[model samples]
Target: MELDFWQQRWHENQTGFHLSDVNPCLLKYWPLFGGEGLDENKPATVFVPLCGKSLDLIWLASQSYSVIGVECSEKAVDAFFSEQSLSVQKEKSENFNIYKSEQIKLFQGDFFQLSKHHLASVSAVYDRASLVALPEAMRRRYVKHLAAILPASVSILLVTLEYDQALMAGPPFSLSETEVEQLYGSDFEIELLCREDIIDEQARFKERGLRYMFERVFKISR
Candidate 1:
């Protein structure tokens, strides 16, 4: 999707996809991937790409890693800080207003404009809505840019949806296991940590006349 599309969505408050609470999967599984106790006093940072106003950022902060969120929408970035009741001091970067606080900083600009220097301090990635939010044409470019800028030690926790594509056009694109491996195989070791079939429980998806809903968590390491 184009950047304008997202900006318009946020302007219209059309963020039905934004979760009201922290993701359950993140809370339950974050510890397995070197959570708070594992990396104390080390000054490690985690990168959240295209981060919406999900409470996952707060959760990540609680886990002891400084959080860096890159977002294109100004409304989303503003809402994130405002809802948290935190004051953001904005500074002008080359192409963004860097909204910064103690443990969190948000870059309000194109994600592609971010350079290695901006992300060099980061050691891990937590992607809940980034990859799957893009269309097929954009996904490869996103991955390539991410791989180019991020260091090899950076690990990633990625969540994806899997379902029949013919039924609906999606911001939440469906990705199969094979596609996941193929996309990140070049430099990252991708592990499937969990997969859940939720065809029965999701009445909304079922009401759309969809047959399946699959949620998968992947761990990517270099």
Candidate 2:
């Protein structure tokens, strides 16, 4: 998607895709990575890319890992801190403003513009709506940049939506399981953790005449 597309979305407040509550899937599956007994010895930072105003950042903070989030829209970044009732100090950079608190720091700029130095400490990534939010043309570049910056030890928890794209123009783009595997399989050990058909539970898409919706979870490690 063009930067203008997302900037306009933020300007018009057309962010219906942003979730108000922390994702349940994040809470449920996160522990499998490092919350309890699993890999607590891993690094202490988690990277959240294209992270809009999701409460998942707060959940990450509660888990005791510092979170670094990158977003293009300043409004969305501001909303995250305001909605959480946290006071943040802003540091200006050439490409972005770094809004920081005790546990979370957000960079306001193009994700691709971010340097490896800023991301050197991050150990993993949590991508909920980020990948699908991009248009098909941008997904490859997005994945490539992510792969280039993240350390070899990093892990990824990604969620994606699948559906018949012929029926709808989407920001919540449909990506089949095979497509996801093709995108990241070369670099990481790709594992499919779960796939669920949530067509009946998806009221928004159903209203738009979409007949099917699939939710997929993927784990990627280098």
Candidate 3:
């Protein structure tokens, strides 16, 4: 999808994917990557890409990790801090604008344009909606750029949805298990942490004639 597609989504408040609460997968698995009971002397930073105004950022920060979120929409980024009633300091860069507080730092710009310099300190990644947001063509580039920037020790906690694409068109696309392996298996060690049939929970998909819908969680480490 082009920038306009997402820009329009935010502009029109067509953000069904934006969850009001922290994701259950994140709450359950984040600690495996050192999100909980963090040591003050050795704090880690978690990088969140395509982080559209989700409550997960605040939850991550509350776990004592510095959270850095990259979002293309300035409106989404602004809403994030504003809705939280937190004060942010802004700085301008050639590629993006930075909105930062004590625990959170948000970069308003393209995720693909971010470099190692921008994300070198990241010790882990939390991807709830990023990979599936793109089409199959861009997913390859997203994984390539992600692997290029993060350190070998960094682990990723990714949550993805899988379904029959023929049944529905999506920004919340169908990402099969095989596709995840193809994308990140060569570089990172992949582990399927959880898989659940969520068709009943998703009334919209059920209404669209989708017989099956599954949510899968993967733990990826290099």
Candidate 4:
């Protein structure tokens, strides 16, 4: 998908993929970081790519980690702060605008264009939607750029959906477990944290002839 595709999705209010509640997988896995053995400390800086006003941002902030979310839609960013009732300060940079509060900063711009400098302080990544939002052609580029920009030791908490593509087209694309390994195995260790058939939970997918849909969660580290 291109930039306009997502911008238009938000503009038209066609965001069925946007979850109203914080994801359960995130809540379960987040505490593993900054615990006794993990390298990450409390008050870590977590990066969220393609983060479209996800309630998870506020949840992460509530846990004391500073959050930096990169979103292409200004409306989504504005809605995040407004809906959360947080005060924000806006500033323009060379490539994107920064919407900042004490614990959260949202970058309103292209995710691919952001460089290492923009992500230098990122201690961890929480990718709930960014990877699956792209088509197969773009997924490789996204993973490569993500590995290059972040520190080598960074860990990632990722969630993906897998289903038969012939049954339906997707913005929530079908990402197989094998593909996930091939994409990040070269540089990061991959651990499958959760995998469960969620087709019954997804009414739209059931309507689209998807007999089975698996929601997979992974813990990735270098």
Candidate 5:
């Protein structure tokens, strides 16, 4: 994703990609990571890439997980803390502006610049929209970089959309099942949790001239 594109989107308040509330799929399916049994005294950390002021961060923190999120937009970072009424402190790092509260720390910078040391404590990852948000060329680089940096034991909960690209241009791009396998298969064991035909439910996408759209959820383990 281009920095200028996202910066312009944030400046113009053109963030339809920003959900009004936590994603329903996350509410119903987060426990599939089997992280609930982890010791509460030493909470597991969940990394959310390309996170954009999502309410899911709040929900995950409430579940006793230390949450780490990376986002490029500073406005989105500010909006998250302000909207949630969480007082946050800002700190400087070599590559990112770190925002912190109780259990959530959002690194504001380019996602590709992140390294393994930055994610040393992560036990799991939740990709509610990251992978599907990128174009075809960037998606492969995104996955490869992720695989390179994450610990071998990390688990991921990924959500993706599948639709015909010919029907529309996308940042909410259509990612086929085969593409997902090709991207994550070699390094991780993938499990399909569920898939639902959602075109009828997505009035906005329907308006964009899409006739069919499917949402798929996968639990990926390394």
Candidate 6:
């Protein structure tokens, strides 16, 4: 998929992937990484790729972690700060429109254009919707860039979906367990944190002809 695909989605307000609340899996499994696991030299910062006005940013800051989010949609970035009732400080960089409020900063631009320098203080990642949003080819490219930019010892909390692909097309694609390992195993230590059948909870997927679907959460340490 291209950048315009998502920009259009936001423009048209076709955002079924956008969640209204902080994800339950995050609340349950985050403490497994523990507070001390982050780098002690400075405040811990979590890099949220393709972040789309997620309430998770606010939740992370409440727990004392600084947030660095990279999003392609200016609409999404603006909506996040507005809905959160935050007063933002804006600046222009070579590749991004950087917006800041308190401990949260969002760089609005293409994810591929983001570099190591932008994530220098990042000690962890929270990927609730990013990985599963792409096709196989782009997903590979995404992982390669991520591995090259991020430092070792950074922990990633990733959530993905699994289902029969022939049943439906996707922006929220189906990713099996093996594919998740293959994508990140070369760059990080992988652990299956939890897996659960969540098809019943998702009424839209059921309406789309899915027989069953599962959600998987992984802890990937770089």
Number of the predicted model whose lDDT against the real structure is largest: 4
Q: Give me the runs in candidate 5 sitting further than 4 Å from their true place.
A: 35-43
> What alpha-carbon RMSD in Å does predicted model 6 have with respect to the real structure?
1.9
Off by over 4 Å in 1: 35-43
Off by over 4 Å in 2: 35-43
- Candidate 4 segments exceeding 4 Å error: 36-40
Tens-digit lDDT track of model 3 for 136-184: 9899999999999887678888999999998888978999999999999
After superposition, the stretches of candidate 6 with alpha carbons farther than 4 Å from their true spots are 36-43
Total clashing pairs in model 2: 0
User: How does candidate 5 score on lDDT?
Assistant: 0.89
Candidate 4, residues 14-93, lDDT tens digits: the string is 99989999989888877776674455465379999999999999999998889999999999999999999999999999
Better of 2 and 5 by TM-score: 2
**Which 10 consecutive residues of model 6 have the lowest summed lDDT?**
34-43
Candidate 6: clashing residue pairs, number = 1
Error of 3 at 136 (Å): 0.6
Candidate 3 Cα errors over 4 Å, as ranges: 35-43
Candidate 4, position 170, lDDT: 93
Residue-pair clashes per prediction, in order, are 0, 0, 0, 0, 0, 1
Clashing pairs in 3: none
TM-score of 6: 0.96
Error of 1 at 22 (Å): 0.4
Q: What are the per-model C-alpha RMSD values against the true structure?
A: 2.0, 1.3, 2.2, 1.3, 2.1, 1.9
